[model samples]
Target: MADSQWVDWTKTTQSKNYRGSGSFATFMIVGPVCFFLGILFASFPYDFPLLWTSDPVAPSYYDQLETHLRFVHQSPPLIARLLNIIMTVGFLGFFIKLFRPSEANVLFDGASLVLYVIGAGVYIANIVKGMRAVSAGVWHTEDFKGIAHDGPLTGEIVLGREDSLRVLSASNTILALVLVGVLVLQAGQWYAERREAEDNKKADQADKEAAERKASASAGSGGSGKKRQ
Candidate 1:
């Protein structure tokens, strides 16, 4: 009967821990996706609004094969806009997950939440800027010695896009740092909990052993008393 009760209690504890772990699970999943997408978006060649009017470099200063390389590669504008929106969505999802209650300490959770929120906002702002540039029909650009603003974008629009991109670069860095912080804090929490569990298990075993010894002693005493009687 005691063994069955022990098993039931262990199952109950496991279920509780699993339920409390949902937020951590969400972090593990969404955090990597957001990180990868952020890096990929940042690495994309054409995130700014610029236009290439001529060859990338002087043909006279380059070899024949190098001179033929076009700096301005045309891409589908609609597809680019769609991808920007998708990036916004990804950041939004990541931000939402930050608020999910986890097993971390309150301070650690709050710090992670603040950092993640800032990062998500910055990334979304960058995406929104790109979307605006795309709508203005001037987001595609390439590396050229004589790069010009040939697209239908104003100076303000271009500046805003550039500024947002720069800010997002910084934000991505912060987000990566926050990921590390969250992992460390949660890992510590898990470790502490595990240690407490092991300690409790040891104490329970000691108690059970002591109880068995007491029972054996009592039985022996009772039998001796009976024989004496």
Candidate 2:
């Protein structure tokens, strides 16, 4: 069944309206990549500490000279921002692929891509804001106040704390959800096509079998009549 289904799929793909293999492969691959990137972007802020602090037991964190000097402290925001840039480009790629001619649900794809752009835009803004705030020697604490910390804090700040980073995290989640919907809609279209091809093949086989059986029965009847004469 799988092999026959593959044959049917190959035939459908060979149609003039079907795009080339490159677009087809990208259509399948890029969506999930965007989704994973969304998850990474959403989770990264929580994993990194915003407060700059050296002392583990310190109650109040300050923006110490070492925080600026230490590359390790700055790496998290830098890395996150870089990844955000990559994912932003990924969203563009997804958008382009979504708009390409295909048999999938175009309306759903277009809507999903629009939501993706909006969500990614919000996320990018949040990350840029964080990077800018860190570079300026100020950290937006979980309570929403900007604090000047001496070193990076180990405690995790949950997103949505009335801060711009909250917007970033929320947008990432929204984008992920939208991408998932796009996947579902595309899958639905593919499944429908596959079922249709299989049904057509079945109908053709049934017709051929009926014709062959009628011919065989007629041949048997003619032979009996000759023998009886």
Measured against the true structure, the TM-scores of the candidates, in listed sequence, are 0.46, 0.50
Error of 2 at 187 (Å): 3.3
Off by over 4 Å in 1: 1-18, 22-114, 125-168
Residue-wise lDDT of candidate 2 within 43-151, one digit each (tens)? Answer: 5544234322333522232233224323333576676666666666655655554443443424434555665566556545654454454554334344345433333
Clashing pairs in model 1, backbone N/Cα/C closer than 3 A: none
lDDT of 1 by residue, 24-62 (tens): 544553455455556545543332221223435433432
lDDT of 2: 0.51
Error of 1 at 170 (Å): 2.7
| Weakest lDDT window of 10 consecutive positions for candidate 1 | 64-73
Write down the RMSD of all candidates, one decimal each.
10.9, 10.7
